[model samples]
Structures are given as structure tokens and as C-alpha cells.
Target: MRVFGMQHIGFTVPHLEEAVRFFEAAFGAVTCLETGRIEADDAFMQRRLGVPAGCRIENIKVLRIGNGTNLELFQYSGEEDGEEPLKRNSQSGGFHLAFEVDDCHSAADRLRQAGVDVLEGPTFVDAGAMQGLTWLYLRAPWGQFLELVSMNGALGYERAGGPKQWSPVTGE
Candidate 1:
């Protein structure tokens, strides 16, 4: 079976409100849905993925930015005080999420001005057909990696290196 593109990314947070605010301010994500009573099985899906169950599952909020993907945030009711999750740059299971921007440098600057901790710059990268394109990495509020890439073409089908050539073949 062939795999399609990503649908959404989930993150477990101690405070859903704070997480939502952070994302809204940092990435201009808009709240799409907020529910306090998600099914137990649905909540357990996150636990099945290795999230500790000590925290009490309370609410879930979904936010969407642009038309690419959605961010799912969950908040537990009685989570014990513990160490914060490691930063995206650090060794972690899910590293980070990338957002294509019109101007990486301006995006980084805007994020910094808005009080978000931007790790690196709108540095240039040789992305094949997208040669001389600029890209930058930023740390999200919950230690997740958010990348901003600026290029001249579309998101995934950018003709950076050169034009893609297709050849037709006959099925036997």
C-alpha cells in the first residue's frame, strides 16, 4: 500500500490553554475544535503511543494553520509535576514540524519579535531545484521543532535542482 501525506500531529501538554495560546501566537494557528469529553479509547490512543498515563485526561483542542495540517493538543487534569520534555534539537522520538514560508528570514524575524525562541536563522540551503533557498529552525513552546522554509516554488513539488523528466513504460 502506498502512504499518503500527513494528516495531523498530536502533542500532549500539561496545560491545553497555554499550548493553544503559544501555537496561536507563534504560528498563527486558529482553533478549530475544543472538546472536554473525548472517549476513553480515544484518549488511550495517545497512551498507547508511549505517553505516560499518570496525568488525568481532561480536554483536547485542535488547531489548523493554512491548509496543510492540524495540530492536536491534549491536556490532562491531574498530571504530576515532572521534568519538561526535551527540546526538538535534542534526541527525541518526534523531532519537529516544518512550515513552508514565503520568506524564511522575515518569518524568523517576526517569530523573534513576538517573543518566541528562534533557534537558528533563515539560512540558505541547496535544495536541488530550490537552490539558494532560505530555511530556518525554531523551537516551539512545548519543545517541538518548527521549521520555516522559504523558496520560489510550491511546497512539495518545487523544481529546485531541475525539471523532473517522466518516461512512459508498457505493462507486461
Candidate 2:
């Protein structure tokens, strides 16, 4: 057996309201569900969630962005909470969620106008396998890395009859 498709991607944030608001404004994310505070004074937090005992989960929310995976936003409070800064791309386990757009340049401009921290270009790939692709990186209000990408027509591989990559734009 094998996995079918991504159900959701979850990440803990320092502030749930700020995160939800940022996602909604930035990506037009829709809030699908929310939960009240969840806390336990025993090993449940440790055994089930691998967190320190007596930790409290302040809130949880699920958001739908475009047609991609549902985003699970979590806010927790405990001794270990906020102990580390957000990781950069150069660090291990560093990752960013990419949103496919029809026009990378326009999207990046809009993001910049909205006061989002956009980094550098919607860089164009002029050669190699990624030719015809454009991408830009930006940071969410809570420091999560995000990307905007666009593929102009077909890429080098797709032009050669390679398997088309799945996209929210094409739903392939």
C-alpha cells in the first residue's frame, strides 16, 4: 500500500490569531475549523503529542489555501514553547510551502504591497531542466518560509514529453 495524497500540514505558531489573519490576507485562506483550548496535566501531552507534561494547547485551527493541502495552525504553551527561533533554509529540516501562481512577478508585487517580507526576485530559470520557471521567496508574519512559483508554458522536461508534474493550477 502507498499513501494517496497529502491530507494536511501542521505547524505550531507563536500566535494563532496573527497567523490566521496573515494567511487569510496573504493567500485568501479560509478557516475551516477551530478548537477550544486543550490541556492535560499528565503524560497525555508527552505520550500522544511528545510534548512536555502539563503543556497546554491554547488553540488549533485549520485553513484552506487555494486547492492545496489544508494547513493546520497550532498554538501551544509550555516550558518548551518559543525556546527556538524559526529555522532558515540553510538549516536542517528547513522547508517552505510553495504556492503556484499564474504570474510570479505580479503575485510577488502584490505580496510586497501587502507589507509581506518578499526576498529578492521572482527569479527566472533561463536554462536547464527548470527553464521557463519563475520563483520568489517570502516570509510569513510568523517567520515561516513561503514561495510563489510560476511555470511559463511547459518546462524543459515537459516539452520533451516527460510526465507532467501535479499542479494546483492544472490539477494534473
Q: Rate the local accuracy (lDDT) of all candidates.
A: 0.69, 0.89
The deviation in Å at residue 122 for candidate 2 is: 1.0
Each model's number of backbone clashes?
Answer: 5, 0
Q: Which pairs in model 2 have colliding backbones?
A: none
TM-score of each: 0.72, 0.93
Ten contiguous residues with the weakest lDDT in model 1:
163-172
